[model samples]
Target: MSDLDASTPRIFLARHGETEWTKNGRYTGTTDLELTHHGIKQVKGTAIQLVGPGKLIDPGRIAHIWVSPRKRALQTFSLLFNNSSSSIGDGTTIAKTKVTITEDIAEWDYGDYEGLLVGEIRAGRKKRGLDSETAWNIWRDGCEGGESAEQVTERLDRLISEIREIQEPYMNGGNAVDVVLVAHGLILRAFAKRWLNYPIDSPLPLMFSPGAIGILSYKNHDIDEPGFYLGMALPLQD
Candidate 1:
């Protein structure tokens, strides 16, 4: 937190920890799955290292939070603040932060391909002559009976507008209005893309590992110049 500009509000993108479907590389969109024991440990570790007063994500500084409606994301958000109580490393309470469970930040709807592996999806598509021309690409072709890349872009853009509206007033120095979004892998990446005004089908190679955290903020403390942080060092805390 110290390494970055305080005047620029940050959006902490937290990808939910691993589930059985995530571990098996299955398409988990729209599926309600609980975190595995190991996944619980992953988020707990993230909480200790990145959350708390003077840490990368100070609960006290967060003004708003958007969580995916999925259970895994809900579990991750709870674990992030230690069950949403004053039980984090420094016992800083985030109860004041506005938390919204939103479908906008949820994973891409896999629709007919839900619960299927990548190879399985490809094979299915090939068998049906769906990808006979250019192969199956979620970014390009989207999921069958689910959402298209354009549809995803629309929702994500709307969410980004809401976030920017909240962050605009605070960008020039005021009460900390940082935001937090707890959700899944693919959606978070797409959110990042939209945050930077990139199209959802851009070639940017963005990957969000489970339980990982990424930061988005404005450049030069200007809300109009949104950008993502490549890396940030945690502040030293007593």
Candidate 2:
């Protein structure tokens, strides 16, 4: 068995590939969009680099996959597992991995700010006599008429609890059991913060690029000590 299998379980957070809105810097919450041609290639490349036997994300070890309800995230999941014939692994790993489409991992609801760029949002807020002196910060001010940081924290905390429950059993020496979350950029960043017990409203320097993957795991193989992986070596093949 690989050393990773004997260590703490991990959560693989995958951001969906680029869309026209994403590339153009628009807030994409609740506005379901498809991936562009380039986006498809990006995810396929990530799969080749990360998802396979003896790779960072060996799909056979993934216990559960929580995907956003949006089509973009769904497309990413399909491409990552080679369901679209992108050909990363043998294509049988997904069949054994449990996948769920959930709103819990969806992007932060941008509401009135949906489809608008950051500058546009700020201008609109100023026109409406909101935040006239200060610029708009989604993490602190949140989107107008949309969810707040506290609300996002509530939902994410609940989902984190669920993920912990799933991983607790196999955390100690056993078969590798990991969880995968396919979602949007902002929310995934927020999720990472929450995983480390950090407030979502805090200054977040985390940057999750399009089609990027981030790993979260317990430190020192202790479930009580959650931490993010800055870098990890590949598991040794038996």
Candidate 3:
């Protein structure tokens, strides 16, 4: 059993809201795009859910809020936590506490096919008997100039290590420490894979709709022998 399995902490992962490429099903890696109007509403909606009853995360108690350096992610983080009027007045406000930007949390590098649509890529690959399924799953086989699932796993592992350092100071405290991460789709899924202890190369059976949120926490009663608990909220389509 790895150390992550032993001291798993509660974390909230929020995928950045929709972008032009996202709505059109293009490979949106590394490219910085703004949130559509609907995307903005989704972020605010998720924020409201977090701030309401039965879900209130005490601002004063949150351990850390990490965000991807991408413009979209940074903007989402700002909109979510920068509202002083909506703040609970307990923990550090968004403006006061700079949400740490982590490169490890950025989207997967899509390489040669960065802006291409799935169908377009598939049609071209089909000329050589390759199809969409075979290509999109390229992470398993490795894509040209793109990071493989194994490489992404390495980055996710590093992020988990950083989380451990944060836990060292709070081990004795009975209170729960919460972390919120504003990141990209693939990176957020990578984090999920880490939390679940899944093989990164294993089929990405998981899908994160834009603006969706997930909770990573322990399920078992025993802290010494903790179990991973994953809760996913589907992104609103309409």
Candidate 4:
């Protein structure tokens, strides 16, 4: 952004709000679902508090936006931008950036485990002897019919490359330039890892909550340096 101190291009990763499955601790993907009422309210509040003139994220600074094809993710994006209107409270307007539905940022395709809870999946695997001493983890074992962590990493890396190609110049273009991605929890966490050039096999320090917001930027206004974790907006309790 023009007002920002550095030329580092900032990325805003907005995790989609809560869904029925998420509320119940299920692995939701592929089977598109809508946000819960509280989820809608969460994202709307996030919008009003973070995006606007002179806010934490200036709407005018956004240059590109990518949203998941899933309905929940799209709904979250809608709620984020629909915080207000003419003569409304706070009057936060949506960014003019074109929103693209990207498969790259879509939730990790949970496939066979789409509607199953983690505990259930693990118990099933243990029952079938598919798992032994270790509990099931998507980052490594992945779903039987779903994408692996390596596959997810590949896709996210490609997306990051493209984002850099498009936003690098804009970052140095001497004007406001930030990118926004609205997607699911796991995928966005994977994205954060890849954004920081971390190996997919590494343990992630944090898990994103539904309707969470995290930022990624260069450590020193230089892309060659490691990416920095700026901060998050409205972090949910574990």
Candidate 5:
């Protein structure tokens, strides 16, 4: 019999490396782009920081790792774990882990303005009589070529439920391990919002830079059970 615990799981979320589009301040929604050299190095640094002191992450306990279906994200995941590859060194304890490619975890789909910048989108929205604020915050207003805020919430909610299932053993203490998620900016922010049980309408001003990580601790709420709180954003700078 397999006993899965969903009571207390700490989800470690990371935003994938920076892409050319992201460097240009363009909306990278669904548009796949490769990460810059600097971006690649940035994510590698995050891996180093995790194993450092003051942080309680046990590399061996990371049982599962997840990344978006995009090439950039996949590449970042590979590089981050490349040191663990048995082919790389004579003898190194490369933590055995499984990387899962998740599709629903993709960034917000920016329908028509897929490659356009936020400024450009705002200008267009204004010409079309849409409120500038609304246009700027398409996530809140559900703009012309993008997903509505509610839709984003629904998608993230479903993803979170699945993530909990994936890390069920860890959550229930069946597996003394951690789960790593390599996703995008908005997706990570959405996870934060859901983790804190924040209002659905709250604007997500928290920007996750390339290689930034956010942690969330989940606990079943009960009369005698105390909830847990995870730490805030810890940026992995160059």
Candidate 6:
């Protein structure tokens, strides 16, 4: 981890809400699934707790928003910022932060394994004379015909570096150098680990629930000691 000033920069990692694959533990990459009705309601609660004035995440403080190009993630972003249903809240009250759709944040490209659960993929590999027991950790053994851990790390490193650049000018300018990222589970986890300079294959035991929110920031606002802060309001109250 790097050391940072009192307010170096903040990157908020938000996993999209539940989709059919989300609830099924499938490896969802290019296959997009709309949020479940329950998932919509889930994120609405997150918005109320985190987006409004005097809340954990002041909408005005956000400098840039990056979301995956996937429809699921876009849906998640919309529900959080511009919810149209009465159950979610009014979009008019939310700040209209410009959102960028980026492929860097998309889920791991599972390739031939897309939409297959871990067990199913492993079983298939074993039946094909391949080691599936422990040789199939996505971080180490990337999906066939898809991205490798090295590829994912390289992409995330580039994205993280650019994000740093985006926030550089805003440092100490009284402008919040806060960037929000809405993406899928695997890639988002990899991004968070990469932010801390952790090896992509490090068995870090990190887990992300559907619609989970994770925050990364420099230690004391300095760009050096990057660390994860358990500050995001995934949910506040009813």
Task: Report lDDT per candidate.
Answer: 0.87, 0.86, 0.68, 0.77, 0.66, 0.77
Instruction: For model 2, name the residue pairs that clash.
Output: none
lDDT tens readout by residue for model 4, 112-182: 88899888888888888987777888888878889888889989999999888776665455766688899
RMSD (Cα, Å) for all candidates, in order, is 1.8, 2.4, 6.0, 4.4, 6.0, 4.4
Q: Per-residue alpha-carbon lDDT of model 6 for 1-238, expressed as tens digits?
A: 3222234567878888888878878889999789999888777767756655444454656777888999999998887766533224333343444577889899999999998989998888888888845556888888898999999998899999888887766555467667889998889989988989999999888888887678887765566667898653332334
Model 6, stretches more than 4 Å misplaced? 1-8, 84-97, 132-134, 169-173, 231-238
Task: For candidate 1, give the lDDT of residue 26.
Answer: 95
In terms of lDDT, model 4 sits at 0.77
Whole-model lDDT, model 5: 0.66
Model 4: CA > 4 A from native:
1-6, 85-97, 170-173, 230-238
Rank candidates by TM-score, best first: 1, 2, 4, 6, 3, 5
| Model 1 C-alpha lDDT per residue in residues 1-238, reported as the tens digit of each score | 3554477789999999999998989999998999999998889889878887777887778889999999999999999976533364566776743889899999999999999999999998888877767878898889989999999999999999999899899887687889999999999999999999988888899888889999999898898899989987777767
Off by over 4 Å in 1: 84-91
- After superposing candidate 5 on the true structure, give the runs of residues whose Cα lies further than 4 Å from its correct spot: 1-8, 51-57, 84-97, 132-135, 166-174, 219-238
Q: Write down the lDDT that model 1 would get.
A: 0.87
Better of 2 and 5 by lDDT: 2
Kindly report which residue pairs in candidate 3 clash with one another. Answer: 59-91, 60-90, 60-91
Residue range 1-238, candidate 2, lDDT tens digits:
5545446899999999999998899999999899999999899889877887667787767789899999999999989986433343354467633888899999999989999988999888888898977788988888778999888999999999999988888777476679899999999999999999998988869988999999999977788999998977776645
TM-scores for every predicted model: 0.94, 0.92, 0.79, 0.87, 0.77, 0.86
For model 6, state the Cα shift of residue 189 in Å: 0.6
Off by over 4 Å in 2: 1-6, 84-91, 235-238
